[model samples]
Target: MIQNKGEMTVEEVRLNEGHAFLKGKLQADLLYVGEEDGRIYSLSANLPMEETLNLDGIVNGDKMCLKWEIEDLSIHIIHSRKMNIKAVVTFFASVDELTGVRLPVSLDDETVSVQKKTMRVLSLVIHKKDTMRLKEEITLVSNKPNIAELLWYTTEVRGLDLRPEENSVKAKGELFIFALYTGDDESGTLQWIEHSIPFNGEVECSGCISEMIPNLEAAVINQTLEVKPDADGEERKLQADVVLELDMKLYQEEDHEVIMDVYTPFRQCMPKGRKEILESLLVRNFSRCRIADRIEVKETQGKILQICHSQGKIKIDKIQIVKDGILAEGIVRLKVLYIVENDEMPFYSMEAMLPFSHVVEAKGITENSVYYLHTELEQLSTTMVDSNDIEIRATIGLNVLVIQCSEEMILEKIEEIPLDQEKIRNMPGITVYIMKPGDTLWNIAKKFYTTVDEIIQMNNLDGDEVSSGTPLLLVKKVEE
Candidate 1:
């Protein structure tokens, strides 16, 4: 087989006159002279041999695209006859990676789809060869040298920076890329919790379970052993309230693709940019082409995105803001503390629906402007025990910073460890008072400033059965 050295005159370069893209430097077929030796040549480019063109491991049939040359190749070849191409796209089937050229195709078609593949072994003289033997480098490369010539299925949009609030600041930005996935119902769930229980003197508690058991051994002997003999708990929280502080989160769905005419407006009236991008669909001949449709000069769509990102800020009394870092959109996710006064300490115990914190577009707000007003409150609750000692606690969704406070401050919720025996004994119903004549549970409750229910609870009474001479224990107050 006769091998051809690829070469052609520069006359074939096609010029799309009036093309908006023609404004820049061009590399078209104008330089490929249909020159040929007595034998068939592989391929050649407009570049001189001394130029030493570097092919990025391009294999035959591999898709190639245009990128700005870091240095001017024409300047480097100063003295040589300068050749320029219109920078028109080309398709190749056979390639010479070493020479950076595409071989002629046997078939005839203005637009061709490659069918078969072939490779070759060629040699270049570095300096010398001994005994008529040549050292050859065998590399397989693609004939197609233009990205617009190959078949690509995947498309990417990148470098989309999103600034919800302002510019010149370290605002949040994200690349909302498009995707055409093969399936749906792809989802995941995330969760976390900090649990606590209130405590008072010697209470029983089971150790943390190592594993979940479905059924315990159904035997009397096992039941006794499971009782945990000598488990002797050192009075933990026997009487307590369980609280869980939860943070709810929400995220929008990703991986969706919409189809519309390439000329359709994106982000509403915000320019699908020049409407000329519709022409590039012709160049999309291949997918991986990073070429921005000649119209949207940006690598990807850059516009005002509609983000219903609903992570809202909480409105609280006195707030201490602790910031960590910027969110995906460049907004600051803040940590705020709500201050509670001793007079309002009891209010902290009742949990209210937490706030919805999110990013919002700020208008006319300056560096000195107050961004938002926090309305979240530090929740709390308290009850006077039978003995008049107060037990203050943080209700659900709130944290307890401390047990007793004479002044106002920020507080967090912690497990109420068991109180001292003295404190427990001092609580309202810890001790019982004996009943006297004319003291019905309700009557005695009123006289002693206690509750009828407290009296029944004190004596473990199931009903209103109270004999005049009967003795009963006093529990707590039944207020008017």
Candidate 2:
């Protein structure tokens, strides 16, 4: 095979005790030159895959968030028409469980005191993994040659902008289609065409609103290009089918009061707490990296006569949190198709692996930070440096999301018991208390076996706040 590309699609996920089962399929497109005709050709195949992952703290009802990519691929040709293909696929997964933290909404006993505080939380509203398909048919103009046989094709989706509305989302983007085919002329020469197809679509999403914060990830997963006949009975029409896989997460800001601490004149209450990490959106950055390199044509590979089409794939190797930014190190695998100075084989393809390193600005990022990074080939071009060398220029777009994580103690429930009779009885009915540095109205009231409202009314205070060393009057409630 001359070159290849691949994508992984996850179909099902089943969670059990501390493990997850995944079923998926891998699609690989292989490009090769014909043994007898010396002409280029393309073939596609799907391989079913199953994997078992050891996921800690996973349960049956927990939601599994999974994503996968083809990390590496290798093909070995056993014969002219037979080959062995092996792919290393990488999967990233996380588990999300919905649980309720129950704080006492209202205590039936009036003597049970509660200290409540309103917390602003960034809650996950919706997590959706969906797909959208785009289809287009185009006819070649008079200037372009009619297709005799389709050899190879590549497609990219770019500038996809999404807008959320009431229960739906609108997406607009352009699909870049590149194809190399043999012409139907007398000489049967090879020809290439590049076209941009604009597309707009809407997806129905339940509980989606414009005000919600959206984090979207999209990729061109599957595609097909077919040659067909035009109205004039010429093979000049091209049909393109593309599938875009989208992963969307929407968040909303909400405020709610949860009991932080509690006490009472009649009982003692203890709050059961669990530690959890709260993720807040820090920054969403779309940046570009420009790559320029020269590739020297070896003597074995024929000299380039004219450049036709160029395409690229980005593979990120590592990501590190550096000072004031994130450092991404990766390689851009570029394929360039050109007409060679040869009579038998007029067209040839060359491949190159160009290494690149870029830093995306993400201030305050650390080792504990969570992030999502995606890269796409925005543009690529080739210029002849000399008879034996070619210059490659490319622009790679980087989409990144840095999430700020914070640990919080969530109160789940409260346990109550009878209060110490000795402690309650020894307290005076009324006393003048001095507010300390860390004192609050609720804290003092709980200490003196009273309520925040009663303390404020008795002290004639404007609000619940008091300065250190300020004297406050406290009164204990007596039984009726």
Candidate 3:
């Protein structure tokens, strides 16, 4: 086999009590040289998959998100026309629940005082998954050769631009299409065509509006290219159909006056607290990194003559948050087909794994930050350096979206009861108090069941701000 490419698709996702059911399929395209005729040929295969996953604290009505990757693929040849393909797929699932804290803003008793704070938080507006279909008919130029038989092809979706609308999203991108075939000439030589086709489509997304923050992801899940006859009855036109999968998440910014601490001076009150995490969108960046290397060919393989076609895929192994930005380490799997200096076998192919490390600039990224990164091969080319080495130059595109996560103690509930009368009555009417480190006027007032204004008035202070180790007089309030 010369080369193979595979992709995964999720057909259905069902959520039940503490469990999730997934239905998907793996599609692969393979290219190989024909043993009988010594010509290039192609084969396609599909493998259906069904899996049940156990999820803790998951229900039917909760929102669940899922993602998958092709961890590994191995192809074994058993006979001349049969092979065993093994694929290891990994799926990640998550559920997002909307949790809130209820804070007491006011007390019924007139003598009680409440402390409030204003906080900015992120609120999720919508989370959904959608799909879009694009179709186009491309005609070859006059100088290019007509297609006789197509052996291999590849499609890449890049430069995606999305805009929010009232009830949908406008998406636009370019498809890089490449195909290798034998021309309709007597020579029967290999000919290839490459083109960049621009396409735009609209996705129906409920509750989507303009000026909303959107974290969107798109992928070319399925595509097809076929040769067709033109109006003059010549095989000069090609029909292209593509399907794109969209993962959309939108958020809105809101401000609320939350009660950080609550205490009632007229009675005893305590706040029941719980830890909650809040996440906000930091930045969305699309960056590019270049890769260049040389592959040395051994004498046993063959001698190169001319380059034909090259294809590649990027696989990210690890990502880390560093001082300057996010560091991504990964490998690029590249396959090249070329003409060899031989009569029996005129074509040869080779595969190489090139390692790379790149740093994406993110100014304020920390350890607590979360990121979603996707890598793609924007451009790749192979050139013959000498008889035994090939030079490879490629451009890798990086799309990253980062969010900041922070934890806060939220007041879930507040319990209030009557104060102890004996303790209040035994307290002295007048006394001298000395301030210590980390002392605040509000803390002292809450301890004595008084107000900050009364403390400042009794101490003859300028304001609530007071230094440590300062001596002041305290007066207990008496029932009128």
Candidate 4:
């Protein structure tokens, strides 16, 4: 009788072969310009002006955050005898290469197999052309401030959008610029002035494929900014030049046959079996979640006033994978700039560090599974209610990817009992035996304790053929 050993677990081996790279460019123009007096202050400054100019650039430094390559970046100020202010920006980009599995695998009732691989898909950048470019002209009429110095200026990317087209990728997003300067107010007292502007635009990526989608975990790799005063402008007018580089990675999920466990139940005596097993890494889940929360300002921070701007940063501290879900622990750091009810300074900056813990739904999570968690701030908004408190709203995005290492095994062979010799020797010698239909020499020899060669020689009569009811001579092997 054939016995079935229930099932055994085992793993298959696979290797990462190579990668494929996608290259493209991102180009746009700045929309915001400052004008003072009869002179026009544009991005390209030509005239001689006495002022201190400051510039800053912001980018992501995490190596494992995403895979991308920046080939070149350039920012130039465009000057026209008629136009007020204009800037040209360009970015050369290349994404990390992705490779799919190419090896062959086999599956059957006795064996189970699975394949692990990585795939890279392009993420197109998208943004509103009008909303991205923010331009405004402000004059401190009360202060009647003279253009003495440009203190500091910085640029950052808040969000990005990508979409696939027929043969190219569509990119859109906004760049946020903040500038701080020292100036004199109406009373001739020295004060700090803050100004913010946003530039938006959309471009079609020529070398990108249309089937790719925005990655759940895309990130900005590097960025550069240029700020200069227009020489011809009489008043303190400033122009900004900006450039940005982005990186995106693609991921794919596949299902494979894996052995859970194994057992066998037919043999009277326990059969000895051998097992074969392997270890492999597998991705269980890849998804993103948005987290929204509020923060309140304390009374000690002074009375309610106007809020200038708010920024949020998220850092992950720990991650735990449990049954059917995953738990994440992190802290949200918030920085706010606002005016106090009776403060001597025009604006006060306050920073708040908040601890947060959240759970994401993921099925089939076990203790043996490993995980990677990445978080980013998507949006931040604040409202002032009274002199003592302000309400803040923040939107955070979380990316979770799970991996599992599994083992599989299969029964190579089984052990069985030996044949009984005494019963075979007890058969009568020279006895007349009736031939049976559907009989073979080997089966007959096994039944009579004789070898197939002995049975063939003894029953010769022609070949090893016997008809039903035919008489045959049977002999039990005598010892020696």
Candidate 5:
């Protein structure tokens, strides 16, 4: 019942190496119109953006996601006449960013080595001919009879979906529009009107590999809307021209394995231990949360007639990883529009902040895991239940990705093995030994001052296992 013990040496080894970059032009077409003007003219555009990452590959390494930036944007007037106008918006984006490392196998392979020195890069060049086009006209909702001047507008893209296609990738999402303008009622009194419009569109990325997973990230960088009165219309009509710039990035996830440690217990050595940092993905999950609340509209503003529009934003304040789940806390910023009792200024606006707490079910989450969370306001609605109270209901989408980075001490190899001459010389030349259960070749060889190979050669052993009461021939190694 002697326990075999040995000291060992270890070294760190990197298994795979690669680099990441964008291989093509990231393009999106946004076709929209002003709500107030029947005829439109482009004023100015600016693109403000936020960076995002998405994982779109198989569980194994070799799937690619896209990381991109908008370098240049342009808007062209395709058709400009009367109250109706059409324009084409183009996004010239660069996809040259790398996300976190992707490792395929967790900790199963022993001999496999992966060292990712540089990430892999995929490039896409989107020409005008390859660009996807979106066309939609927004109807104006206003109590005023005539449109005066379109002031400004803002747009947001939400509920984005990236799907892998045959030699391409498809991006699908919704657009939320907010427009403000001055208008005249029947009495010719100047008043302000705010309107919201929702639209949907899809874009296809050509020349993409079928195996490539498109991780799509989009943001509205710049938007411009202008209103111009059309003299030809019998009724008081205006032309509205709208322009927007959107930026997108796509990324693919890569996975592989590397050898962490190696050891042999039969030899006596002063093994040096070394520490190495290993990185791997823990979990990726998507969940939907519903939030319900009430807000009071002051009576001085006016009696609530109808809920016209609602928009919301979610900010993640804190995230904690606990056993079997994740705890998330955040605040929801809401803005609602309602019609008033007066016809002169029929629309009234109100803002409210709602705090929320939610627990997402994620198995295998631990305190040592690192995570990234993205929250989106998917859908929002507000209803005027009474003259003083407004009912608000919203759906938020949360996407989380977790990664684990841990340090491990590995055993490389044996450095030295000191032999005992006296013990070797006293060993028997030939002996008939009865094997018992739980007997191993290494243990028996060590007891006889011989090596496992020598015993195997002497007794013509087929395998390392031995049965109880089985006779074994032991011949000690003779000193030359």
Candidate 6:
């Protein structure tokens, strides 16, 4: 509310419309693959209302007009269940020359927002057909009666086998996901989580892992991630260039290492009271769903909105994610940065953290989303350490409002789209009139710069046509 554009002040700006990890392996098998933790059960942007945009009762200083209404509204999601497939600090690896090393996986989610002083965010969506399952929907319309919240996350990885091994065979990988966040009163419910880590690192040095060999030439194991937002736990620790690539067809070359399990989520911000048209209680039939590409109410809480919904997904390597089942269909992308109306205690909520991984034999086009990997060998050699410990959490909700913005200035000294002929001789009816012969518009608007119903709406004459002498084209602001 601090936009002092040289105020002569007379403003009434009419307007309104707005909206994983893994590690482990055989120092024994030369490092097999181990080390990972988990947490990801997404699609719960927050929902709960009933306060009605401030009205303890004020009786003064221009109330003009403002209104709102909403009852029994709900929407919320946050769930997971995949204890620990198998990992003792070796779920992602890369170490094979003697023969072994191609494991590294771990992916987590991020995207957040919160404002207060004005708010009218009416949308936030992330639906998937992988991980285990998925769904999340949010919509709003308010003037009064408020409570807003939306926060999302994404992280993933897959089986990393790399093929062709003998003296050491230990490449085991596992990750899963499931979500359904669309609740205005419980309807779309399903949030499950699971994480199993086992990817021992090895790939001493051979040469030939990228030669067009599907005859068997594939091994791309990459895992790189860095997300920050730590209120008290000192967040931000992941440096030295992120890299996770696994593509093979048949090669004697070897230098592979994979280990993943770094799912982090902790988004929080809550405040509510205003409504007019709110929805999200889960009842999705999106006719199959397809329109993604509009996310930006301030990043809408993200992992790039889970890679804009979902697709093939190739990267510099983030951690823990494998979606073949959890839900299906992927590809969600959007961008609209900001449009705040005012600002200061109108609505704000923020929370984020979702670790992901999926794969249970559920491939391509059930609608869409199909990405790739695997590691496994349980002889407990890197030092035998495991006991079902999969943990990664999230809680994202942010609402902040204070909006009323409109700018269209060009008055400096006045009139510049052509027109200043000496201010029309100080305006207010310019003199010089002599063209009788049946003049019109009531005799040329009495001869000069204005009136006569503004010269019949500035010469669009129909009831002011003066025949015999035509010379009319006056201007000084005339538009009904």
Error of 3 at 19 (Å): 5.7
| Residue-by-residue lDDT tens digits, candidate 6, 240-286 | 12122222223122222212111111212122222223211111111
Candidates' lDDT values, in order? 0.22, 0.81, 0.81, 0.44, 0.52, 0.24
Minimal lDDT window, size 10, model 4: 1-10
Q: How close is candidate 4 to the true structure, as a TM-score?
A: 0.45
lDDT of 1 at 275: 17
- Please estimate how well model 1 matches the true structure, expressed as its whole-model Cα lDDT: 0.22
What TM-score would every model get versus the actual structure? 0.12, 0.83, 0.83, 0.45, 0.54, 0.16
Q: Return the lDDT, model 1, position 413.
A: 15
lDDT tens digits, residues 84-168, model 4?
A: 3222222222222223322223324232111222322112233111112333443443444655544434444555554445533
Q: What's the C-alpha lDDT at position 231 in model 5?
A: 45
Candidate 6 local distance difference test against the native:
0.24
Off by over 4 Å in 3: 7-25, 47-66, 72-84, 94-111, 161-170, 209-213, 280-288, 298-305, 320-327, 359-370, 379-388, 397-407, 425-437, 455-475, 478-480
Tens digits of per-residue lDDT for model 5, 257-353: 3333222222333444566455455566889899899888887888987775677767667888877778899888776766678754565667788
| Model 2 regions lying over 4 Å from their true place | 6-68, 75-86, 91-96, 103-113, 265-285, 299-302, 322-325, 361-369, 385-388, 402-409, 412-421, 424-431, 476-480
What's the distance in Å from true for residue 255, model 6?
Answer: 29
Please provide, for model 2 over 232-344, each residue's C-alpha lDDT reduced to its tens digit, 9 standing for 90 to 100.
88898999999887778887876767566767655677778888776666777888899899999877768878877777788888988999788999999888877678867
- Model 6 per-residue lDDT at 70: 19
Worst 10 residues of 2 by lDDT: 98-107
Q: How many clashes in each structure?
A: 70, 0, 0, 30, 54, 210
